[model samples]
Target: MIEDDAAVRRGVVDALEYAGYRTLEAGDGDEGLRMALGASYRLLLLDLVMPGRDGFSILAELKKKRAGQPVIILSARGEEHDRVRGLELGADDYVMKPFSVRELLARVEAVLRRTCERAAPEDKRMIPGGEVDFSEGRIAFEDGVEEALSEREGELLRYLLEAKGRVVSRDEILRHVWGLDPAKTETRTLDMHIMHLRSKLRDKAQDFLVTVRGKGWRVVS
Candidate 1:
């Protein structure tokens, strides 16, 4: 939990603990950013407006470094633009300030559900000329090339591989991979990530990650 307001932070942490969840609290943005990037927490609760390294900056850094980390933004700014910005910046959900404990917990549970479900499996997968080791976040090609997979890339590839050649919709990807509501979120983000993933996978012919026109994406393997 990261909030500049001590009272709000304390209440949220207490409520989360009461609900049988372990909690870590950061009273300012700097501490929040440090702990958020370094800690082993499953989820982050962030306040948007804070002194010294605002939540938006922290969120951007987190996305770049730990794209798979689940985050929910909490703020007094309830404007549509604010909410949209949060989601676009890779927040799994956004909760307005003065929120009830029940509502906050519900949102937390929903986000966590999506997160736990999409986590990469422990095993590695052998592809045509390469192997993807999920546990180590590394991909090795047959000709002695190896590359590290970012957390998001690893999870995306894992999901596509699990689809077993079936078309997985952009909406499904948004929900499963991003933990965001597909109906409310834009699909363009999904496409951009797909492009990045293909480049990383070295899909020269686009043979592996196939796009089904007017539908979704599929893994040819």
Candidate 2:
């Protein structure tokens, strides 16, 4: 858990340990971000306001690098916008400051359970002009050319194809495919990935992957 307040951190850590959960603590955001990015943990408990590097910034980076990581925001900022922002940024749950230990633990358990129950996407799918083998991480075109797809590319295509015949919002794509909070500024990353996928799929005319203006994207069925 990454929290700046020492007394609160200590109390939470103690409570968690007593409940049979292992704990790691960081007093500041810089150290917290490093550990969050490098460490292997099931869930993260984060604080919003902190000295040097705030929780939101750290959360943004974490989502970009470790999209599937589950996070819960612990903050005194109980405003509606703050909660909405946290959720948009991919926080699985938000616990307000001055919360009960029991409630916090319950939230942790629920998030972990939900995360564990999520199923992995299918390993292979056939696109319009080619076949995408996610397990092989490559696209085999009908014309005998194969193009490699990065992990992110494969995920993007998989999500789009899964939602074929309907427009999938950019926010949905970011949250599901990129494991990011859609509220974070700018979707250039999503746009870039879409561009790359189009090129790799040889959809120069956008016949397979089409963009819906003011909405998101759809894989033509």
Each prediction's TM-score against the native?
0.59, 0.59
Q: Per-model C-alpha lDDT, please?
A: 0.85, 0.86
Predicted structure with the largest lDDT when compared to the true one: 2
| Clash count per candidate | 0, 1
Q: Look at candidate 1 and give me any clashing residue pairs.
A: none
Cα RMSD, model 1: 11.5
lDDT of 2 by residue, 111-181 (tens): 99998787887887888777889999999988999999999998888877876477777766776667666
66 Cα displacement, candidate 1 (Å)? 0.8
Q: What is candidate 2's TM-score against the reference?
A: 0.59
Please report how far candidate 2 places residue 69 from its true position, in Å. Answer: 1.3
